[model samples]
Target chain A: MAHDTIIAALKAKFAELVTTEFRDNFRVVVAPARLFDVLQSLKDEHGFNMLFELTAADYLKYPKATDRFGVVYGLLNMATGVRIFVKTWLNEPDLTLPSAFPLWKGADWLEREVYDMYGILFDGHPDLRRILMPEAFTSFPLRKDYPLRGRGERHNFAVITRAES
Target chain B: MPLEALPTLPEGPEKDYLWTLNFGPQHPATHTTLRLILTLDGETVVTAVPDIGFLHSGFEKLGEDLDFNQYVTIVDRMNYISPIMNEIAWHHTVEKLMGIELTPRCKYIRTILGELARISDHLLCAGAQALDLGAFTAFLYGFQQREVIYDIYETISGQRFHPSYTRVGGLLFDVTDQFIRKVRNFVKEFPKTHADMCRLLNRNRIFLERTQGIGVLSKELAIDLSCTGPLARSSGVVRDLRKDEPYLAYPDFQTAFKVVCAAEGDCYARYIVRMEEMIESLKIIDAAIENLPAGAVNVDVESKAVFPAQTSVYRSIESMIQHFELVMPNRQWTPPVDEVYGAIESPNGELGFYIVSDGTGVAYRARTRPPSYIHFAVFPYLIEGHQISDVVAVLGSLNIIAAELDR
Candidate 1:
C-alpha cells in the first residue's frame, strides 16, 4: 500500500486521537495518554509491526509549549516499508507515559533508557531500572536544569598536596 | 506452609547442582563494561542476566545543552568507529526538520564518506572476530586496511576518528580533487586485499569450527528484538535504511548490493554477512567517487546557524557576527520546540538520534538508540548452551562496541 494511503487511513480511523500532523512527511503527533491504544491499533490492524526506535526530548526552552518533555516513537512496516512517528508529551512534575513493552518487546531497554536520562516513567515497564546511569546517580542528567559543565569538581587533595608538600 | 516442614536433600550422596557466576562489569569477553550474571548447571547456562551502564556518559543530557551544529561533534562519538554515519543521520534529521535539501555534489560526497566508514567498521568486526578465533594474521591484515582508510579520513577532515565533517545543511568543505584521486586509487586496490583476507580466514577449519552453528537467532526473535543492519540481514530479513529509506546520495547512486542472510542465523552467518557487506560497501564507494559532481559543498555557509569562514569574518561585519555566534558557547543555534528521531544505517546496525528541541540554544533532550545496546541485551541468550570459549567468539561476531552500547 502507498504511504499516503496508510497515513490517510490512520487519520480517518483515529481522527480523534491525533493532535497534530506534520503533513510534509506524513508524521502525526498523538497525545501521550492515548498512545498505547493507537500504537496497538497500528500494530495489529494497520500492520505497523516493527518498533524501529523509541526516543525522547526535553521541551524546557519553548515558551507556552504544551508539555515540558516529549517522547518520540519511530514505527515501521517491515513488509510495506512505511514509517511513522508517534509522539507523547509529559509535564515536568510527572514525566510518565504508557508502556509499549506488552505490544513490542523491544521497548524493554529503550524505556529504561528514557527513565534513566529524561526521568520519564513508563508505566507498567517490566524492569524499570536505570539502564545507563549508575544506581547511585542522584539527578537526571538529560534534564534541561542539569548543568552542562557537569557536577562541580571535588577537591583533589592527593595531587594538590603532592605539589605543595 | 511452615518453613521447617520443607524436605531437604541428603548431605554426602546428593548430586552437586547448578551454580551462578557473575561474568562482567570487568570481564574481557563482555566487550564494554557489561556485567552478566550467569546461572550454570554443569556446562549449560540456566539463565543469563545482563547488567549494563557502567560506561554511560549521559550524552543525551549533553545534547540538551548544545546547539544543532555543536551537537554534531557529540553524535560522532556515539559509535566511535562509525562516526560518519551518525553525523550524516543527525544532519539529515535536522535538515528535514529545517526543510533544507542538499545539492547533488554534497549528497554524493556524503555517500562516499558513509561507505568509507562502513568499510572501516566491517574491518574491525571481521578482524576482531578472527582474533577471537585464534587467527592473529587475519586481524593484522584487517587492521592494516583500516589504517589506510583512517589515513584517508585524516586527509579529508584533519581528525582521524571523530571527524564532524557533516553539518546540517551540507559538509564542512568540498573534497579536493587530490583527495578524490586518492580515494579512487584506494577503491581500485581494496578488493584484491579484501579477497586475500577472505581467503585467509573465511574457510579456515578452526574459524569454521568455532563460529559455525553457534549463536543462532531466528527471524521472528530478531524482529521481536528489533535487530537491524547485518544482524537482521543475517537472519534472512531484507532491510537496509539506505535502500528502504533513501537518504543523501543513496537515491542517486546505481550500485549492486545484497542484504545477505542465512537460514541458520548462526555466528558464522553473521560473520559471512559482514564479510560480504565490505565488498558491497566498496562498490558503493566506487559508484559515489565515479559520479562525483562540481558545486558548492555547503548551500548556506553564510547562514546564521553555520560557522563563517575566516576570510569572510575579517572582511564582512555580518560574517563576523555569524562567526561570533557560532564560536560563543550557549549563545546561538537554538532548535525549535519540536522533537525529531533521526536514524541512519551504521555498520553495526541502526544508529538513531531522538532529539527534543525546546526552542532554546540547547536541545531539551537527546537520546541515541544504538543497535549495539539491543544486540548486547540478547547476548546471554545466544550463549546459553555453548562452551565457555565460544563466549569470546560470539561477542566478537556481534561487534558490540562498548562506546555505543554503554552510551
Candidate 2:
C-alpha cells in the first residue's frame, strides 16, 4: 500500500502509536511495552537508520503531564532526509524500557547517559552504567524534583587543601 | 637481561597474557580530562575502556535554570576550540524553538563566523594530532594560524578564548569595519600556512607510516557508531550536513561546493579530510564576506524573549528595555509548550540541541547531542586491534573534546 508520509506508514503499521508534529518534526509517541519492536521495525523496515540521540525528561512537576518520564529517541532516515523523535513514557516505580543498542551501536553511551541523568533503566543493554556522574551517585540530577544546587552531594566529598598536599 | 639489545616480551605465566594499562584523566596524549583503561595483550590492545566525565559540569542541568541569553555563556564552554560555533548552534536551536526568523544580514554574518570557527577548530585538531605524533614543527604551524583566528575572535567578542558572542535573535554586537578587514586578511593569509602545515606532515614518511593504516574505521562502523563530520567523511560516508541540511548560508556559497570524502577509513584519510575541509571553510568565508547582505544585523523581533544587539540598544529606546530584560535573566515571554530539535553542522560534527519548553522562557529539558560524546564512545572500537602507539593516532583523529563528552 502507498503511504503519503512516513508518519502515515508508521501509523498504519502500528495501531497503538500516536503521531504529533512540532515545528516540522514528526514525534511518534509509542508505548513502552513494544518500544524495541517499534524501533527495530523503524530501522529495518522504514529506513530510520540512525539513532542520532536518546534521552529522557522528568515531568514530575509538569502541570499537564500524565507520566513521570518521557524518553525521547532522535532518529534520522539519511536516505530520505526525514528526521523524527520516537517518544515513549514511563512512570514512577517502573522506569524501564527496551534498549535500542541492537538497532544502533551508538545507543550504548547515549542510553548510559539517560540512565545516569534520569535513573531510567534500559533492558537488555550490555553495559548500562552511569556515564556523566559518579557510579556511587544515588540520585538522578536531571529530574525536576532534584534541586539545582544538589542535595548535599557536593558537600559529601572530602576537602583537601593545597597546604595539606 | 642483555644490556646491548632491545628488551623482548617476557614469556611468563597466566597474568602476563592480558595486562591492563591506565591512560589518562591526566596523561598528556589524552589532552586531559579523558581517561582510558586499556586491556593489552602485550602491545596489541584487546580492548580500550573509555572512563570519561572528569569535566562534567551538568551543562544540560544548567540549561534548565538559565534563560536563553544566559545559557549561551555555558554552551560557549562546551566546545571551547570553536566557542562561537556552540553559541551559533545554541541560538539556532533557541530561535527554531521560539519560531524567530533571523534577518538576511544576520544569517550571512552567522555563516561567516561559523565557517571561521570550523577552520579554527580543524586547525587545532590537526595541530594537536600532529603534536601527539611528535611532529612539533607542524603543530606550531597550525597554532600560528589559530593565533591569527583568535585575534579575529578577540576583536569581535571582546574575549579571546570564550567569546560568548551570539545572542538569541542576532549577535552580541554588529561586526565593525575593522573586524571585516581582519577576516578578509585572515582569508588571504591562511592558505600559505595551511600549505606549509600540509607539506610538513602529509609527505613526511614517519608521519605517513604512523597514521596510514592505524585505527582504520570502516565506513559501516562509522555510520553504525554514529560518527559524523570528518570522521565519517574520511570513512567514505559521503554525508555532509552543509549540503544535506543546508542551514545558515551554506546553500548559497558562491564557490564550487562539494563534500570532501576519502575512500580510506584510516587516520591518514581523516587528516586529509580535515585539511580539505579547512580550505572549503575559507572559501565559504570569502563568499560570505564579499556578498554580506546590507540590513540590520539583529532581527526586528518584538518579542521580549529575544534580545537586541548593542547597536540597536544604542539607537532605539524600546530596544534598550529589551536588552535589559534579556540581561536581567527574567522570564519575559510565554511560548507554546512544545519541543524542537534543531541542529547545525558544527566543526566537530552534528551539534544539536533538543529543547522542551513548558510555557516559560526557561527550558523544561535541554539535551545536547554533541559529536564528541559519540566519537569518544567509538574510540574503544577503533583502537581494539591496534598497537599502543596507534591509540594516540586514533584518539587524535577522533578529536574528542573532553568538555563536550561529559556534558
Question: Top lDDT: which candidate number?
Answer: 2
Cα lDDT tens digits for candidate 2, B1-407? 01122123346786567877788888888976898887788899888788877999889999999888789999999998899999999899888988888888889989988988999899989999999999898888888988888898899888988888888788878889988999999999999999999889989999899999888888888888888889989998877888888877777873445789998999999999999999988888888899888888777756565566568899999888876766664546566798889999999889999898887778888889999999888888889889999999888888889899888
TM-scores vs. true structure, each candidate: 0.89, 0.94
* DockQ for every prediction shown: 0.42, 0.54
Q: Residue B133 deviation, candidate 2, in Å?
A: 0.8
Q: Model 2 residue A148 lDDT?
A: 91
TM-score of candidate 1 against the unseen true structure: 0.89
Question: Which segments of candidate 1 are over 4 A away from where they belong?
Answer: A1-15, A23-33, A92-96, A149-165, B1-16, B300-305, B325-337
Which residue ranges in model 2 land beyond 4 Å of their true spot? A1-4, A161-164, B1-16, B301-305, B308-330
- What's the number of clashes in each of the models? 2, 0
Model 1 clash pairs?
A58-B365, B64-B363
Q: Cα lDDT for residue A129, model 1?
A: 76
Write the residue-wise lDDT of candidate 2 on A1-165 in tens digits: 122467787778888988888776778899999888788888998887788888888888776889999999988876776788889999989988988888899999999998989889999898877777876788989988889999988788778999998
